[model samples]
Target: MRVVGNYRNPGPQDEYSQGQGGYPPVSQPAPVRTEVNAGRLWAGGVAAAVVAALIGLVGVLVARAVFQLSPKSSSAFGDDATVQLCVVAALAALMATGIAHLLLVSTPSPLSYFGWIVGLLTVAAVVVPFLGSGSLVVRLSEAVIHLVIGIAIGGLVSNAAGSASRLTLGENR
Candidate 1:
């Protein structure tokens, strides 16, 4: 018998000539399953926090030295600007990482949703300072700081989610 296709000669049990077959049926490979690595996610979170804190520190320095603006808090307890900004940035980074982890575990498309969440939060943070009774320079500086922190958190965490995951194939679905 002549084989009409590129497939190798069929075996005795193969039914290539059953009906409209040119070659034996090919079995499809199994789908791959991906699992996230929690340790890498945590490392990314820490790195993001450190970067955000540095950004906040730089913002504070620029506000004070370059713009000649002093940031004042509306809270009851007077707080050091540098310390408060850095702490808040770090906390925000950690919070973003937690949210990212939850989304990655629960949702199929984590990055898209995470981006929306971080972007909206960043907008709110920027707008919040404008509503307060701060000088233009202070408001602008705070907004910049918030923007930088948001970028760091969103970019780093999403990248981490990709890097920390492992894909396993050939497993039964």
Candidate 2:
């Protein structure tokens, strides 16, 4: 007979090492899966839209009442320029949400990509008014409004994407 110790070497056929009614076998951990919750993301998108519209309204009001500035009469939106601005701001928020969702689904480090894209777009919006044939004050006011709307869209949607994603371990059984 051989002396037995509390700890024994586990051979290839050992039942405990094989997880046979004993200690489970050591194995690599399951990979994690990141799942996006669409409902939450869309809800955040809607909130962003409302915020953008409100920003547009307030920006226009401030420019008109406080600074006595207004969009050019020959603008594409014509006489209803304020109303058009609000609508466009809301639409831009929604579009940003769409881009965020798309990136979350298809890319790695999606928020980084989304930030860069939205930032560039915002800069473009801020610059376009200056390029047009408008007075300095009016163009500056328009650029400011666009900047605010872009910032609101980018920030709100990025927060939404973060809150809507969850990580789960892949099935291991």
Model 2's TM-score against the true structure = 0.76
Flag regions of model 2 displaced more than 4 Å.
1-29, 70-79, 171-173
* lDDT per residue (tens digit) for residues 4-116 in model 2: 45444566667666646454435767977678999999999999999999898888777777765545674432347778888999999999989988988878888999999
Colliding pairs, model 1: none
Which tens-of-lDDT digit does each residue in 1-173 have in candidate 1? 54555445765556675565477555667765567899999899999999988888877776677775543652322247678888999999999989988877777677789999999998898888889886787788888878877878788888887788766674645
Measured with C-alpha atoms, the lDDT of residue 49 in candidate 2 is 95
Best by TM-score: 2
In terms of lDDT, the best-performing candidate is 2
Considering summed lDDT, which 10 consecutive residues are worst modelled in model 2? 1-10
